[model samples]
Target: MENANRGYERLFGDDGLTVGATFPLTSARTTRPNVGRELALTERLEALGFDGLWARDVPTDWPKFDDTGQTFDPWTWLSRVAARTDDVALGTASVVLTLRHPLHVAKQAASLDHLSEGRLVLGVASGDRPPEYEAFGVAEDERGAAFRESVEVLRAAWRDAHPEVETRWGTLDGTLDVVPKPTAGDLPLLVTGNSRQSREWIAAHGDGWLFYHLPEDALRSYLDDWNERTAAPFVTTCTVDLAGDPEADPEHVNQGFRAGAAWFRDYFRELDAWGVDHVIVGVRGDDRERAYERVAERVLDRL
Candidate 1:
């Protein structure tokens, strides 16, 4: 695959840095179902000048995780969003690669990439939910291995013709060649968190990194560490509760920064300064329309 044809390079840049937000399609369920609001919201986001819309992959409910974000199938939601918007990029905050077959992921992602005209950014991680892993008949400790294997398989399937893949999970002996190759030749793949993999491997293989909210200093340190090891860019996702008042005080969510428009603007500037290439803002606990409007009016213009 040509380097210029990589989705990450096109969506972000050579630096791999862009600013984006998580759409409230799933979280703001009171208004309508995801499919109903997807197109309009996507168009709104693109019109508002946002770069991308990130979706989450939640196969099952986990009350203990206290995950307030909507649990939707990332691929399906992205496909719907892709059909709706013409420019804004589509992504998964992460799809738990350990639980699913890599070939399945490669095929679906390639199809989505082609359908979306090469606007797919894939974030993958080793699943942490013990119960979910157990249900899938995969041991907890095996997640790391599974994650590595999945990455290898997906890359091979996408780049190699009739590639042979073998691992404990499964094996493929040149019997299949996934169809609908990515429009960009390769889909951008970001590694979310450490996922039990070493920084060296992640830096070497991943196109980017997906991380959560951390203190400025901590985030800077992490970015420095990642940069030291690899030139690949980094991507971070955060839950944001945009306040109506431009001067509203900042609050906190699990991995979000709760602040008014003014603060949000400054925060993004800081992130940009810190060398964060792209930020996927997860919208939670806000008046959906008003919050998005505020961001569009105040923050998007400035970014």
Candidate 2:
């Protein structure tokens, strides 16, 4: 927490609300989206003064799940996003830590952090797909322990030189080290969901918490509890399908709501007042460019 990097500051350095958008802005229904259009939209968002651009980690496509989250590997996709935009915080909505090797994750993350000039903010999760876990040869039940160990290993690799470490993944002796430490000497890691760990544990170990969209009253209660537990920032994602009418009422959608610009402006105002640090907004309508512009003009600017 001492060496909080540029990305962290971009998103949570201040004590108010900042807005970001999730990828696949070009297409929401399919796993693969038009990459060129996505990048173009990304640059536009940054130019419009959005604080962050987040990438999702969907290593393998699951048919039952409706959304695949940009379809590209988070690291490589984020690297591309980093190259396209300057100053926008680049983040992983989360990397599936339980399915990957911690050392590899450490190297990839550090490398990305440096290449992005310290703009990488990592949101890591213990994956939920049972079949994917089987495919990766990781035990489903052990993911919680794996998730905890991964966190410890990541911290050790970034903070210490050739730090001796042992966990379910492997053992690292003092002889070897993960090269290219993060640009600011450390990366801000926000634990996604609970990741099968206790809230107390996450509050103690993580730089922040990344949560899914919740109803207003539920979110307020959760935020109050989080405030009581720790001072770490809280980040949440909300999908939006902006209605054509400016004064439309909010209708519940998957993980978010469908509403008009007027309603969203008031909603974000409430979130800011409730102490939510950042909101990663996912626009869901067909005309994403229009949705982006509307959010910036009507929702973000109003706040």
Candidate 3:
């Protein structure tokens, strides 16, 4: 918990409200690797006073789902973003820990955290895609245990003097330290969704929570459940397609809200009232410039 505190302090500071925007990995209809454009967008968001930038982890191909994420590796993109930007915290909405070896994740996360000068927040999950699990040679039913053990391994690897971690996934010799040490000496690990883990486990382990889109009433219920179980704050990411028109009708996307600036203000206000610490907005749809400007002018001011 001390390490968790260090990680939390580096990212959240004292505001208790860190507004951020999700990095757009894929264009509307293109598969072109656009880290440059995404970096430009991130710079714009940073100048516009957003607190952090969140990346998504989509490692495998799953066409039927039509993933909005575009399936780019999160850590690679974040490393690029970290080098490009100075102030904004670099983060992943949720890295699929179950599919990856913990040592690799720990090393990469620690390196990014060090490179970014303590601005990395790692959100991890068990993952839901059966195909992804199959591709990774991981059984669907075993992901829960895999996820738990992975977290344990990562933590053990990053400890003050590193400890031996032996699990079904792998084994670590005594005290195998993962470098570079985090700027705050520990990487913040936020859990996404339930990740097939119990509330008590989450409450005791996770530094924070990453939840997806939910209605206000439902969000309130979910947050209440989480808060009651764990006193730590929760962070949620949702997509938004801001319109030029102030009276734009609300459109729905997967785990996102598409509306005008006015609507966004109201939505964020509701989230603030609910004690949500951070909201990462994924801006999609047309007129990216107008959306960014509108959010900067109307939405960022309120946050």
* Per-model lDDT: 0.76, 0.89, 0.77
Q: Give one digit per residue, the lDDT tens place, for model 3 in 1-303.
A: 365433356456665566777656336435545666767776777787777778878786677867646346788778788888877777787889998998899888888787777778888999878788878899999899999999998888777565687898677777466676666666778899999998789888888888887877889998889878876778887777776687777787777777887888888887877878888776665566567667778776864
For each candidate in turn, the TM-score is 0.90, 0.97, 0.91
Model 3 clash pairs? none
Which is the leading candidate under TM-score?
A: 2
Q: Model 2 — TM-score against the truth? A: 0.97
Winning candidate number (lDDT): 2
Q: Model 3 — which ten-residue stretch has the worst lDDT?
A: 1-10
* Residue 87 displacement in candidate 1 (angstroms): 1.0
Model 3 lDDT vs. the true structure? 0.77
**Between 1 and 2, whose TM-score is larger?**
2
For model 2, residues 1-303, the per-residue Cα lDDT tens digits are 777888999999887799998887787777579888888998899988899988888888888876677888888898888888889999998999998898999999999998899899999999877789999999899999999999999999998999899998889889898998888887888999999999999999999999999988889998999989999999998987788898999999988989998898888888988989999988876778888888898888877
**Comparison by lDDT, 2 against 3, better one:** 2
**lDDT, candidate 1, at 57:** 73
Instruction: Name the runs in model 3 displaced over 4 angstroms.
Output: 1-11, 25-29, 68-71, 243-253
RMSD of each: 2.5, 1.1, 2.3
Candidate 1 per-residue lDDT over residues 1-303, each given as its tens digit: 145333465456645346677745435443324656656766877777778788777677667875534445778778877888777777787889988888889999998888887788888888767789988887888788889988988888888888888887578799878876777667778899998899998988888888877887899999999878876777887767777677888887677767788998888788877888888775664345556666667876775
Show where candidate 2 strays beyond 4 Å.
Answer: none
Model 2 residue pairs with clashes: none
